[model samples]
Target: MTAAALLLWRDFVRDPARRLWTEDSGCGEWGCCGSPLEARAFLEGVLRGMSRRRSRELRAVVDALDDAY
Candidate 1:
Protein backbone atom coordinates (compact mmCIF):
# COMPACT_ATOMS: atom_id res chain seq x y z
CA MET A 1 0.00 0.00 0.00
CA THR A 2 1.06 3.57 -0.60
CA ALA A 3 1.08 6.42 1.93
CA ALA A 4 -2.39 7.58 0.96
CA ALA A 5 -3.73 4.08 1.01
CA LEU A 6 -2.20 3.50 4.43
CA LEU A 7 -3.73 6.68 5.77
CA LEU A 8 -7.10 5.86 4.30
CA TRP A 9 -7.06 2.40 5.74
CA ARG A 10 -5.89 3.56 9.16
CA ASP A 11 -8.43 6.34 9.45
CA PHE A 12 -11.25 4.07 8.32
CA VAL A 13 -10.33 1.08 10.50
CA ARG A 14 -9.64 3.22 13.55
CA ASP A 15 -13.02 4.89 13.49
CA PRO A 16 -15.29 2.61 15.50
CA ALA A 17 -18.48 4.24 14.34
CA ARG A 18 -17.41 4.44 10.73
CA ARG A 19 -16.33 0.83 10.56
CA LEU A 20 -17.51 -0.89 7.40
CA TRP A 21 -18.54 -4.10 9.10
CA THR A 22 -19.95 -5.24 12.42
CA GLU A 23 -17.56 -5.60 15.37
CA ASP A 24 -16.47 -8.88 16.94
CA SER A 25 -17.58 -10.68 13.83
CA GLY A 26 -15.96 -13.84 12.63
CA CYS A 27 -14.33 -11.74 9.96
CA GLY A 28 -13.15 -9.22 12.55
CA GLU A 29 -11.95 -5.97 10.94
CA TRP A 30 -12.23 -7.52 7.54
CA GLY A 31 -13.18 -4.56 5.40
CA CYS A 32 -11.02 -1.68 6.53
CA CYS A 33 -8.04 -2.01 4.24
CA GLY A 34 -8.80 1.23 2.34
CA SER A 35 -10.44 -0.63 -0.49
CA PRO A 36 -14.16 -1.27 -0.46
CA LEU A 37 -13.83 -3.84 -3.21
CA GLU A 38 -11.10 -5.65 -1.31
CA ALA A 39 -13.10 -5.53 1.86
CA ARG A 40 -16.16 -6.83 0.10
CA ALA A 41 -14.19 -9.66 -1.37
CA PHE A 42 -12.81 -10.49 2.06
CA LEU A 43 -16.25 -10.51 3.60
CA GLU A 44 -17.65 -12.65 0.84
CA GLY A 45 -14.80 -15.14 0.97
CA VAL A 46 -14.84 -15.42 4.75
CA LEU A 47 -18.60 -15.60 5.07
CA ARG A 48 -18.54 -18.23 2.41
CA GLY A 49 -17.03 -20.52 5.08
CA MET A 50 -13.32 -20.20 4.44
CA SER A 51 -11.15 -21.84 7.08
CA ARG A 52 -9.67 -19.88 9.94
CA ARG A 53 -6.19 -20.49 8.62
CA ARG A 54 -7.20 -19.09 5.29
CA SER A 55 -8.67 -16.07 7.02
CA ARG A 56 -5.38 -15.46 8.82
CA GLU A 57 -3.54 -15.79 5.56
CA LEU A 58 -5.79 -13.15 4.08
CA ARG A 59 -5.21 -10.82 7.00
CA ALA A 60 -1.50 -11.41 6.69
CA VAL A 61 -1.74 -10.16 3.15
CA VAL A 62 -3.31 -6.95 4.43
CA ASP A 63 -0.69 -6.50 7.14
CA ALA A 64 2.13 -7.11 4.75
CA LEU A 65 0.73 -4.82 2.10
CA ASP A 66 0.08 -1.98 4.52
CA ASP A 67 2.82 0.61 4.08
CA ALA A 68 2.68 1.63 7.71
CA TYR A 69 4.51 -1.55 8.51
Candidate 2:
Protein backbone atom coordinates (compact mmCIF):
# COMPACT_ATOMS: atom_id res chain seq x y z
CA MET A 1 0.00 0.00 0.00
CA THR A 2 2.79 2.38 0.84
CA ALA A 3 4.46 1.69 -2.46
CA ALA A 4 1.19 1.76 -4.36
CA ALA A 5 0.07 5.02 -2.76
CA LEU A 6 3.33 6.70 -3.56
CA LEU A 7 4.67 5.40 -6.85
CA LEU A 8 1.43 4.18 -8.35
CA TRP A 9 -1.70 5.94 -7.08
CA ARG A 10 -0.41 9.47 -7.69
CA ASP A 11 -3.60 10.81 -6.25
CA PHE A 12 -4.53 13.19 -3.44
CA VAL A 13 -1.14 13.32 -1.73
CA ARG A 14 2.22 13.24 -3.41
CA ASP A 15 3.96 11.14 -0.77
CA PRO A 16 3.45 7.47 -0.04
CA ALA A 17 1.29 5.85 2.61
CA ARG A 18 4.37 5.38 4.78
CA ARG A 19 4.77 9.12 4.92
CA LEU A 20 1.16 9.71 5.90
CA TRP A 21 0.22 8.75 9.40
CA THR A 22 -3.38 9.58 8.49
CA GLU A 23 -3.51 7.62 5.26
CA ASP A 24 -5.75 4.53 5.15
CA SER A 25 -6.74 2.00 2.55
CA GLY A 26 -10.29 2.53 3.85
CA CYS A 27 -11.30 -1.05 3.16
CA GLY A 28 -14.26 -1.48 5.47
CA GLU A 29 -17.35 -2.19 3.37
CA TRP A 30 -15.67 -5.35 2.13
CA GLY A 31 -15.40 -6.49 5.76
CA CYS A 32 -11.63 -6.28 5.60
CA CYS A 33 -11.85 -3.52 8.21
CA GLY A 34 -9.97 -0.24 8.31
CA SER A 35 -8.41 2.32 10.66
CA PRO A 36 -9.50 5.59 12.19
CA LEU A 37 -7.60 7.47 9.54
CA GLU A 38 -9.98 6.05 6.97
CA ALA A 39 -12.99 7.28 8.89
CA ARG A 40 -11.37 10.63 9.47
CA ALA A 41 -10.52 10.88 5.81
CA PHE A 42 -14.09 10.09 4.86
CA LEU A 43 -15.52 12.77 7.12
CA GLU A 44 -12.92 15.27 6.05
CA GLY A 45 -13.54 14.52 2.40
CA VAL A 46 -17.25 15.03 2.91
CA LEU A 47 -16.66 18.32 4.65
CA ARG A 48 -14.19 19.50 2.06
CA GLY A 49 -16.50 18.47 -0.72
CA MET A 50 -19.10 20.82 0.59
CA SER A 51 -16.60 23.67 0.90
CA ARG A 52 -13.02 24.02 2.03
CA ARG A 53 -13.87 27.10 4.06
CA ARG A 54 -16.65 25.24 5.84
CA SER A 55 -14.32 22.35 6.49
CA ARG A 56 -11.74 24.68 7.97
CA GLU A 57 -14.36 26.16 10.24
CA LEU A 58 -15.51 22.69 11.26
CA ARG A 59 -11.95 21.65 12.01
CA ALA A 60 -11.46 24.74 14.15
CA VAL A 61 -14.59 23.87 16.08
CA VAL A 62 -13.33 20.32 16.60
CA ASP A 63 -10.02 21.68 17.81
CA ALA A 64 -11.82 23.95 20.24
CA LEU A 65 -13.83 21.01 21.50
CA ASP A 66 -10.67 19.05 22.15
CA ASP A 67 -9.07 21.98 23.90
CA ALA A 68 -12.13 22.51 26.07
CA TYR A 69 -12.35 18.83 26.85
Candidate 3:
Protein backbone atom coordinates (compact mmCIF):
# COMPACT_ATOMS: atom_id res chain seq x y z
CA MET A 1 0.00 0.00 0.00
CA THR A 2 1.02 3.60 -0.44
CA ALA A 3 2.13 5.50 2.65
CA ALA A 4 -1.20 7.29 2.75
CA ALA A 5 -3.11 4.04 2.45
CA LEU A 6 -1.03 2.43 5.17
CA LEU A 7 -1.56 5.41 7.41
CA LEU A 8 -5.26 5.34 6.79
CA TRP A 9 -5.31 1.64 7.56
CA ARG A 10 -3.55 2.28 10.83
CA ASP A 11 -6.08 4.92 11.80
CA PHE A 12 -8.96 2.74 10.75
CA VAL A 13 -7.69 -0.29 12.66
CA ARG A 14 -7.49 1.58 15.91
CA ASP A 15 -10.52 1.29 18.27
CA PRO A 16 -13.41 0.85 15.85
CA ALA A 17 -15.91 2.89 17.88
CA ARG A 18 -13.52 5.77 18.14
CA ARG A 19 -12.90 5.50 14.44
CA LEU A 20 -16.64 5.82 13.79
CA TRP A 21 -16.90 8.82 16.08
CA THR A 22 -13.91 10.34 14.35
CA GLU A 23 -15.63 9.99 11.02
CA ASP A 24 -19.15 11.33 11.63
CA SER A 25 -19.72 11.78 15.35
CA GLY A 26 -21.31 8.39 14.85
CA CYS A 27 -24.82 7.12 14.49
CA GLY A 28 -24.08 4.80 17.48
CA GLU A 29 -23.52 1.23 16.32
CA TRP A 30 -19.97 0.44 17.32
CA GLY A 31 -21.06 -1.38 20.46
CA CYS A 32 -22.43 -4.04 18.17
CA CYS A 33 -18.78 -4.98 17.72
CA GLY A 34 -16.68 -7.23 15.53
CA SER A 35 -13.18 -8.65 15.42
CA PRO A 36 -10.33 -6.26 14.65
CA LEU A 37 -9.63 -8.13 11.44
CA GLU A 38 -13.27 -7.77 10.46
CA ALA A 39 -13.18 -4.05 11.08
CA ARG A 40 -10.00 -3.75 9.02
CA ALA A 41 -11.51 -5.69 6.17
CA PHE A 42 -14.62 -3.54 6.24
CA LEU A 43 -12.58 -0.37 6.25
CA GLU A 44 -10.43 -1.63 3.39
CA GLY A 45 -13.48 -2.53 1.34
CA VAL A 46 -14.91 0.92 1.96
CA LEU A 47 -11.61 2.52 1.00
CA ARG A 48 -11.32 0.43 -2.15
CA GLY A 49 -14.82 1.36 -3.19
CA MET A 50 -14.06 5.02 -2.56
CA SER A 51 -10.74 4.89 -4.48
CA ARG A 52 -12.55 3.25 -7.40
CA ARG A 53 -15.08 6.12 -7.47
CA ARG A 54 -17.82 4.05 -5.93
CA SER A 55 -18.99 6.13 -2.98
CA ARG A 56 -22.53 4.87 -3.15
CA GLU A 57 -21.33 1.30 -3.14
CA LEU A 58 -18.96 2.11 -0.34
CA ARG A 59 -21.71 3.58 1.76
CA ALA A 60 -23.84 0.57 1.04
CA VAL A 61 -21.13 -1.75 2.25
CA VAL A 62 -20.42 0.32 5.31
CA ASP A 63 -24.03 0.96 6.20
CA ALA A 64 -24.90 -2.70 5.82
CA LEU A 65 -22.70 -3.47 8.79
CA ASP A 66 -24.31 -3.59 12.24
CA ASP A 67 -21.16 -2.11 13.71
CA ALA A 68 -20.99 0.83 11.34
CA TYR A 69 -21.67 4.21 12.82
Candidate 4:
Protein backbone atom coordinates (compact mmCIF):
# COMPACT_ATOMS: atom_id res chain seq x y z
CA MET A 1 0.00 0.00 0.00
CA THR A 2 1.03 3.61 -0.36
CA ALA A 3 2.55 5.43 2.63
CA ALA A 4 -0.52 7.60 3.03
CA ALA A 5 -2.80 4.58 3.05
CA LEU A 6 -0.66 2.85 5.63
CA LEU A 7 -0.69 6.00 7.72
CA LEU A 8 -4.46 6.05 7.54
CA TRP A 9 -4.61 2.42 8.66
CA ARG A 10 -2.34 3.23 11.54
CA ASP A 11 -4.49 6.12 12.54
CA PHE A 12 -7.60 3.97 12.33
CA VAL A 13 -6.01 1.31 14.50
CA ARG A 14 -4.96 3.87 17.05
CA ASP A 15 -8.36 5.47 17.26
CA PRO A 16 -10.20 4.49 20.45
CA ALA A 17 -13.55 4.82 18.73
CA ARG A 18 -12.84 2.08 16.23
CA ARG A 19 -15.22 -0.47 17.63
CA LEU A 20 -17.25 -3.51 16.62
CA TRP A 21 -19.50 -3.08 13.63
CA THR A 22 -23.23 -2.91 14.05
CA GLU A 23 -25.99 -3.74 11.61
CA ASP A 24 -26.44 -0.04 10.95
CA SER A 25 -22.77 0.78 10.75
CA GLY A 26 -21.45 1.54 7.31
CA CYS A 27 -18.30 -0.42 6.56
CA GLY A 28 -15.84 0.60 3.90
CA GLU A 29 -14.56 -1.40 0.95
CA TRP A 30 -11.68 -2.71 3.07
CA GLY A 31 -14.13 -3.93 5.73
CA CYS A 32 -14.57 -3.11 9.41
CA CYS A 33 -12.41 -3.74 12.48
CA GLY A 34 -13.51 -3.90 16.08
CA SER A 35 -10.07 -3.50 17.60
CA PRO A 36 -6.39 -3.07 16.84
CA LEU A 37 -5.92 -6.82 17.03
CA GLU A 38 -8.51 -7.43 14.35
CA ALA A 39 -7.06 -4.66 12.23
CA ARG A 40 -3.60 -6.19 12.51
CA ALA A 41 -4.98 -9.56 11.45
CA PHE A 42 -6.61 -7.94 8.45
CA LEU A 43 -3.35 -6.22 7.56
CA GLU A 44 -1.41 -9.47 7.84
CA GLY A 45 -3.93 -11.17 5.57
CA VAL A 46 -3.46 -8.38 3.03
CA LEU A 47 0.29 -8.77 3.24
CA ARG A 48 0.08 -12.51 2.76
CA GLY A 49 -2.09 -12.10 -0.31
CA MET A 50 0.17 -9.54 -2.00
CA SER A 51 3.26 -10.09 -4.14
CA ARG A 52 6.50 -10.68 -2.26
CA ARG A 53 7.99 -7.38 -3.40
CA ARG A 54 5.06 -5.41 -2.09
CA SER A 55 4.77 -7.39 1.11
CA ARG A 56 8.45 -6.93 1.83
CA GLU A 57 8.12 -3.18 1.53
CA LEU A 58 5.41 -3.03 4.18
CA ARG A 59 6.45 -5.86 6.48
CA ALA A 60 8.64 -3.73 8.70
CA VAL A 61 5.98 -1.14 9.33
CA VAL A 62 3.40 -3.84 9.98
CA ASP A 63 5.73 -5.63 12.37
CA ALA A 64 6.40 -2.43 14.22
CA LEU A 65 2.71 -1.84 14.58
CA ASP A 66 2.29 -5.37 15.89
CA ASP A 67 5.02 -4.76 18.44
CA ALA A 68 3.35 -1.56 19.58
CA TYR A 69 0.23 -3.46 20.56
Candidate 5:
Protein backbone atom coordinates (compact mmCIF):
# COMPACT_ATOMS: atom_id res chain seq x y z
CA MET A 1 0.00 0.00 0.00
CA THR A 2 2.67 2.40 -1.02
CA ALA A 3 3.51 4.49 -4.04
CA ALA A 4 6.09 1.93 -5.05
CA ALA A 5 3.59 -0.90 -4.61
CA LEU A 6 1.02 0.98 -6.70
CA LEU A 7 3.45 1.59 -9.48
CA LEU A 8 4.41 -2.07 -9.44
CA TRP A 9 0.77 -3.16 -9.57
CA ARG A 10 0.04 -0.79 -12.43
CA ASP A 11 2.96 -2.13 -14.41
CA PHE A 12 1.90 -5.67 -13.64
CA VAL A 13 -1.59 -5.06 -15.02
CA ARG A 14 -0.14 -3.62 -18.17
CA ASP A 15 1.96 -6.70 -18.71
CA PRO A 16 1.11 -9.98 -17.05
CA ALA A 17 4.32 -11.87 -17.94
CA ARG A 18 6.70 -8.96 -17.81
CA ARG A 19 8.22 -10.16 -14.56
CA LEU A 20 7.71 -13.86 -15.25
CA TRP A 21 9.40 -15.14 -12.06
CA THR A 22 12.24 -14.61 -9.61
CA GLU A 23 14.83 -15.94 -12.04
CA ASP A 24 16.66 -13.73 -14.44
CA SER A 25 14.95 -14.15 -17.79
CA GLY A 26 17.71 -12.02 -19.37
CA CYS A 27 15.01 -9.38 -19.91
CA GLY A 28 14.21 -7.12 -17.02
CA GLU A 29 11.61 -4.39 -17.59
CA TRP A 30 8.79 -5.31 -15.27
CA GLY A 31 10.05 -3.23 -12.38
CA CYS A 32 8.05 -0.02 -12.66
CA CYS A 33 9.64 1.39 -9.53
CA GLY A 34 12.98 0.14 -10.80
CA SER A 35 13.57 -3.24 -9.13
CA PRO A 36 13.30 -6.07 -11.58
CA LEU A 37 14.10 -8.71 -9.00
CA GLU A 38 11.34 -7.67 -6.65
CA ALA A 39 8.92 -7.13 -9.48
CA ARG A 40 9.62 -10.59 -10.79
CA ALA A 41 8.95 -12.16 -7.42
CA PHE A 42 5.71 -10.19 -7.05
CA LEU A 43 4.56 -11.32 -10.46
CA GLU A 44 5.30 -14.94 -9.67
CA GLY A 45 2.65 -14.90 -6.95
CA VAL A 46 0.14 -12.48 -8.50
CA LEU A 47 0.08 -14.10 -11.89
CA ARG A 48 -1.19 -17.37 -10.46
CA GLY A 49 -4.91 -17.32 -9.54
CA MET A 50 -4.91 -13.56 -9.05
CA SER A 51 -8.31 -12.11 -8.17
CA ARG A 52 -9.98 -8.91 -9.38
CA ARG A 53 -10.96 -7.77 -5.89
CA ARG A 54 -7.41 -8.26 -4.71
CA SER A 55 -6.11 -6.28 -7.62
CA ARG A 56 -8.54 -3.48 -6.85
CA GLU A 57 -7.54 -3.45 -3.23
CA LEU A 58 -3.88 -3.31 -4.10
CA ARG A 59 -4.57 -0.57 -6.60
CA ALA A 60 -6.52 1.44 -4.07
CA VAL A 61 -3.82 1.05 -1.47
CA VAL A 62 -1.26 2.03 -4.03
CA ASP A 63 -3.25 5.06 -5.04
CA ALA A 64 -3.55 6.21 -1.44
CA LEU A 65 0.15 5.71 -0.92
CA ASP A 66 0.95 7.50 -4.09
CA ASP A 67 -1.09 10.47 -2.96
CA ALA A 68 0.71 10.49 0.35
CA TYR A 69 4.01 10.50 -1.42
Candidate 6:
Protein backbone atom coordinates (compact mmCIF):
# COMPACT_ATOMS: atom_id res chain seq x y z
CA MET A 1 0.00 0.00 0.00
CA THR A 2 2.83 2.40 0.74
CA ALA A 3 4.55 1.65 -2.55
CA ALA A 4 1.28 1.96 -4.43
CA ALA A 5 0.53 5.29 -2.74
CA LEU A 6 3.97 6.62 -3.62
CA LEU A 7 3.61 5.56 -7.26
CA LEU A 8 0.15 7.08 -7.47
CA TRP A 9 1.44 10.28 -5.84
CA ARG A 10 4.23 10.45 -8.42
CA ASP A 11 1.72 10.14 -11.22
CA PHE A 12 -0.56 12.70 -9.60
CA VAL A 13 2.35 15.10 -9.27
CA ARG A 14 3.12 14.75 -12.95
CA ASP A 15 -0.53 15.30 -13.85
CA PRO A 16 -2.96 16.98 -11.50
CA ALA A 17 -5.84 15.78 -13.64
CA ARG A 18 -5.37 12.25 -12.43
CA ARG A 19 -7.28 10.93 -9.42
CA LEU A 20 -5.70 9.20 -6.46
CA TRP A 21 -7.37 6.50 -4.34
CA THR A 22 -7.12 5.86 -0.62
CA GLU A 23 -8.51 3.40 1.90
CA ASP A 24 -8.84 6.25 4.38
CA SER A 25 -12.28 7.69 4.07
CA GLY A 26 -11.13 11.01 5.48
CA CYS A 27 -9.17 11.48 2.27
CA GLY A 28 -12.35 10.73 0.33
CA GLU A 29 -13.11 7.60 -1.67
CA TRP A 30 -11.12 8.78 -4.67
CA GLY A 31 -9.08 11.36 -2.72
CA CYS A 32 -9.82 15.03 -3.44
CA CYS A 33 -6.29 16.35 -3.30
CA GLY A 34 -5.83 19.49 -5.40
CA SER A 35 -2.11 19.97 -4.83
CA PRO A 36 1.03 18.10 -3.85
CA LEU A 37 0.82 19.29 -0.26
CA GLU A 38 -2.77 18.11 0.05
CA ALA A 39 -1.82 14.78 -1.47
CA ARG A 40 1.08 14.47 0.96
CA ALA A 41 -1.26 15.29 3.83
CA PHE A 42 -3.68 12.66 2.65
CA LEU A 43 -0.93 10.09 2.42
CA GLU A 44 0.43 11.03 5.83
CA GLY A 45 -3.05 10.89 7.36
CA VAL A 46 -3.50 7.40 6.00
CA LEU A 47 -0.10 6.34 7.24
CA ARG A 48 -0.69 7.79 10.67
CA GLY A 49 -4.04 6.08 10.93
CA MET A 50 -2.45 2.66 10.40
CA SER A 51 -1.36 0.37 13.22
CA ARG A 52 2.08 1.16 14.64
CA ARG A 53 3.50 -2.24 13.62
CA ARG A 54 2.22 -1.85 10.10
CA SER A 55 3.20 1.79 9.66
CA ARG A 56 6.62 1.92 11.27
CA GLU A 57 8.59 1.55 8.04
CA LEU A 58 6.12 3.63 6.08
CA ARG A 59 6.28 6.39 8.69
CA ALA A 60 10.05 6.39 8.33
CA VAL A 61 9.70 6.87 4.60
CA VAL A 62 7.18 9.62 5.20
CA ASP A 63 9.48 11.33 7.67
CA ALA A 64 12.32 11.19 5.16
CA LEU A 65 10.09 12.59 2.47
CA ASP A 66 8.97 15.34 4.81
CA ASP A 67 12.56 16.27 5.54
CA ALA A 68 13.39 16.37 1.84
CA TYR A 69 10.27 18.37 1.11
Stretches > 4 Å off in candidate 6 = 1-5, 8-34
Q: Which regions of candidate 1 are displaced past 4 Å?
A: 20-69
Q: Give the per-residue lDDT digits (tens) of candidate 4, residues 11-53.
A: 7556566565333444433434233344556677888898999
Q: List the residue pairs that clash in candidate 2.
A: none
lDDT of each: 0.48, 0.42, 0.46, 0.60, 0.50, 0.60
Backbone clash total, candidate 2: 0
Model 6 lDDT tens row, 1-69: 445566545655555443453344234533343345555777888887899899888778666665544
Clashing pairs in 6: none
Measured on C-alpha atoms, candidate 3 has an lDDT of 0.46
Query: Candidate 1 local accuracy as lDDT?
Result: 0.48
Q: Write the per-residue lDDT of candidate 2 for residues 1-69, one digit (tens) a residue.
A: 322222222332333453453444554442243344444455455556766665676566444533432
Error of 6 at 13 (Å): 10
**Ten-residue region with minimum lDDT total, candidate 5:** 28-37
lDDT of 5 by residue, 1-69 (tens): 234544664554456575464455445554323454464445445534457766676556545533443
Whose lDDT is higher: candidate 3's or candidate 5's? 5
Per-residue lDDT for 10 in model 6?
60
Model 5 residue 40 distance off true place after TM-score fit, in angstroms: 12
Q: Which segments of model 3 are wrong by more than 4 Å? A: 1-31, 52-69
**How many Å off is the CA of 27 in candidate 3?**
21
lDDT per residue as tens, model 1, 1-69: 333443444555565655444344334343343453355445445535757766676556556544332
lDDT of 4: 0.60
Instruction: Judging by TM-score against the true structure, name the best candidate.
Output: 6
TM-score of every prediction relative to native: 0.29, 0.31, 0.29, 0.49, 0.28, 0.51
